[model samples]
Target: MPPQPSLSFTLPSIHDNTKLDCRIYQPYHSNPSNPSIPPYSSSSDPSWPRHAAVVAHPYAPLGGSYDDPVVHLVASTLLDLGFVVATFNFRGASSSSGRTSWTSKPERADYMSVTGFLVYYMHYLTAPQNHARSIEEDNNSPPILLFAGYSYGAMVTLQLPPIDSFLSHFASPATHTAFADIRLRAQHLAEEQSTMSADPASPRKSLGMRFGGDEDLSPRSRGKHRAHSPDPEEKIRRGVKDILSRSKFIHRRHHSPSADRGTERNIEVPCLENVDNLIRFRPAYLLVSPPLGFVTNLATMSFSNLWPKKRKDGRTKNLEDYTKREESEVETEAKLTANPTLVIYGDHDSFLSIRKMRDWATKLSNVEGSRFRYVEVLTAGHFWIEHGVSQELREAVYSFSAGLVKS
Candidate 1:
């Protein structure tokens, strides 16, 4: 048979009604009817057992977008590694709508929207009610989801704290207050634009908060909140942890010898039964060249610089507390030391000082389990424009991904 095609489509900017350009690179397969192959019916319905990886581009204001060569390279490599890859242009980048913001708030919404789309698509293809038809395929397991990025995109990737966080957020409509905030922000921005415009007759456009094509993201029914309940964010975090525990039980039960193996592909059916844990999507993250100094050190120093008068009085105590906190955090970090992360940089990177990069690398290397690796490409700079440098970078990424498969 002929080759299956890659899919391109649009999703509305979660921050506004503008359509964002997105593409899905279909997995390459020699046997379409193989029991392991995920069946692709529509862009929304992909049925099969395969993992997915989404690549976010670099800083948009500096001309980054889905079309960036680095982004395409990573997507292509992931596809070769048997991952269903997705890449998209962020707001005001290339063909996407709205201008990129300095604070990166709007870009976060764009990332969340893309992630929401991927989760919905997974549910559509794998869930019983949305399945096109069932086949007597092998006992194929669900695909693992992976997230990878370069530079600024890598920064976004690192901000996520493990895949379990997503599993919690997606479990139910009641837990998605953050999404509701996005919709409200979108509406408020639209109203502000309307007031400033000269023409009043022009109709206002609104993007509906829909998940899985038909179901509204907003909670359909209301329940009374307990007077002693924690804040909304904390509640959602707890909800996700609880859902994962229950989902794990369902997973063990479905895998029992007496259960129907073929039918267990609809395993998420149990998760959907509980109104809160309705979505069954999770992704692991691979971040490259995240700016540690920019995110952490600068903030720590900003206060000291702003209030020099108070610095001397508090310096000793502050240093003591900071050291204690770091020591405690290191103890916790021991638990995740086995979770490997690879950090690659050019020796002459323009965006990072040699001292800062070296210090970061040293710290990563000292982690107990040694799951962190630091590699410096000789004489190369920030963007890797030097001759053959891009290829070297690609090899490093591909090696890291291949290692994940083996481990």
Candidate 2:
């Protein structure tokens, strides 16, 4: 059977920004109206925009959704602790609106939009109950905004500036320049992609000459024709096209703007191939700059990556791209809060090896000092909670998260 999709709903947000559609995967019993509710439910409330923690789904376009097991585990855990836990799709995320692109500045805006809207909606529907307050008055409310995510979502949560401070700063026209750097970087990348494509030796450009860019690569008739020449010698051809496309896709996803700005400097990944040629890699420190710049740099590098174009030939000058990706990953991971964080990676995960994941996490923990957490599930390929994970694993998740939620 196919998987069930998440439930979708629209909420009006602050500043009259676009009304956002979010996929809200709520716990079955959090609402008391349903007795069949499990232990992790607070279902009795009839209030609108229930008191809950918001789970920001990881890289939604990359098969990560509100229903992803890691996200579900987190959301479900919070729900059982008596919080109305809901995970929403970021715009361009699965079922969410807008074009599919990971622009950090814009995505962060969307996240705050969700936070603002939820706070306002809850206040409007249930007066005298304020769920959000200026950071100065953060403790004044209960069931406060708890934004959580795995990989990219983690970055989003970490990168969120103090909303009240940001709003206050915005009242003055002088501070608008804070957003300019990201805009400039994006423009630079766009220009770079176009210029790089112009190089005559580029394999893509070379292919364009023979096939006629109009035949496949050109904006017109793009994706209209297959590149494989179906001649009798077809068996002689290899699967280069397919493999190259997949590789390109991963690199492209990292180029998204959403994953590249603000407090999004802290990136959470299941695993990393930490050793290369037996040299262990260290996570880079991101505290070298002001919070905004530090976060922006970390964010830019976390979710997006520059593609390393390696032809079947022995040459590889994409060293610049490789260096950039490494720096980005290290800084983001290293910049995590001193409060211990749990980094979980599956052994069987195709993305990277357990050793690599461990090495990166170890180095990151070193940066954050004693306040670091790491977890690895063996025989699990990027998803232990699926076939490989047992009930014990689920219980462990509950036990761990339960410590964070107050009854």
Best by TM-score: 1
RMSD of 1: 16.3
Name model 2 segments beyond 4 Å from true: 1-8, 11-19, 23-51, 102-105, 119-144, 151-335, 367-370, 385-393
Per-residue CA lDDT of candidate 2, range 1-407, in tens?
01121223443333233334453333333453343332221112333224445666666557766556667666655555554444556666654556434446556676665554334323322222222322313443233344556655665665665445443322221111322211222122223223333354454321111211121136443444334433211221222223223321111112223554553343332211111111011111111001123333444553434445565675454665567657755544544544324555555555454455567567766662544555666665544456646443455545545544432
TM-score of each: 0.57, 0.47
Scored by CA lDDT, what does every candidate get? 0.53, 0.41
Tens digits of per-residue lDDT for model 1, 1-407? 11222444456655564556666555544343242444233222343344677888887778888777777777777766666676877787876768866555466667766665565544433344333323322233234566667777766655544555443444432222444322222223222222322233424211111111111113432122323334433433343455444532221123423366554342222322232212333344565555555543342233433332435556665566568648744642442244556667788777677688788678767966667666788887867788998788879878977776555
Which candidate leads the pack in lDDT? 1
